[model samples]
Target: GYNSHSVLSILMQTYMDSSTVLAPVPSFWGLVNSAWNLCAIGKRQSPIDIETTHMIFDPHLTPLRLNTGGRKMYGTMYNTGKHVSLRPDKTHLVNISGGPLGYSYRLEEVRLHFGSEDALGSEHLLNGQGFPGEVRCKT
Candidate 1:
């Protein structure tokens, strides 16, 4: 188990290193254009604009359940230039269910994004207003 952990750590670090070196540098406008194009082209893109007026509130929606309480969650932290992220152990996957979700979901990782200013750095917007930071949990 120790050997596997060590191997995973090393492999992840290597992958990160290679990815950072190989990733292309894009300007703000270029990034925006690419995202817009992807949103227009892709059928299943995320981070879509959520219009509060069209949002339907269901009283019967159950609260989401996370199975991380009362147990230790082992993970490793890494920096990905723009944000700090945590890579959780695969063996100890987080179980999530409830809400509008039809089935259980397993949390893979988590990322934190922050900006030096209050007007920038959020990955998602709330009615077109940006926040200083946000936390994203991947499942």
Candidate 2:
């Protein structure tokens, strides 16, 4: 659930500081192209009928933690960076619900960062939706 731009904004305190990080995960057009490609991959015909996904943003008012696996993740890591090294976060619980769309989670800590490379890149897809090479992490 680290994709909260609002929280990122708060953690950053300003957009000026935000740019120092990286580009937005998944360029909008990239996912569109990927979706179309994936949809046609196993299809019997040329163009295929694919279901589309929409971007949804909501206010993140709750704070949570990570799980046991997440804790072990933090236990073994490298602390070499210009900033404070963030580790695998434990999951904490939230009373609020994801309202059928999302699942309520807890805040244990923060799992460093994982992807093919950096924040601008990741290893998963949103139901096969890939706007760009970059992505967000939420589990």
Q: In model 1, which regions exceed 4 Å deviation?
A: 1-44
Best by TM-score: 1
TM-score of each: 0.63, 0.22
Q: Which stretches of candidate 2 lie over 4 Å from their true place?
A: 1-96, 101-104, 112-120, 126-139
Could you tell me which residue pairs clash in candidate 1? none
**lDDT per residue, candidate 2, 35-139, as tens digits?**
335333443531122233453343764443323433234322453442223334333222222332133333222233232432322223333332223212222
lDDT of each: 0.55, 0.29
